[model samples]
Target: MSQLNRVAWIVTVGSCLVAALILVLSGYTGYAGVTLAVAIAAAINLF
Candidate 1:
């Protein structure tokens, strides 16, 4: 269960970062910032 939780958070962080990257590439800085914030939060939860 712990391992699964870790995996879920990792995937959440990874996907959020990827989405932020795509958003930045498309010039959506505001949305990208939000996604990046979410990624950071997920990373914090990870540890």
Candidate 2:
């Protein structure tokens, strides 16, 4: 299940980035920033 775990992490990072983008478009900079941080953390897990 290693492959599945990697895929899950990738999806998590991708979705977080997308959510951050949406938040930014809707004027939720604070929340967007938090989302970005989470995305960064997820990306780190990719390594």
Alpha carbon lDDT of each predicted model = 0.96, 0.96
lDDT of 2 by residue, 1-47 (tens): 49999999999999999999999999999999999999999888888
Per-model TM-score versus the true fold: 0.94, 0.94
Writing each residue's lDDT as its tens digit, candidate 1 over 1-47 gives: 49999999999999999999999999999999999999999899888
Cα error of candidate 1 at position 46, Å: 0.9
What value does the lDDT take at residue 18 in candidate 2?
98
Model 1: how far is 26 from its true place, Å? 0.2
Residue-level error in angstroms, candidate 1, position 31 = 0.6
Give the range where candidate 2 is weakest over 10 consecutive residues by summed lDDT.
1-10
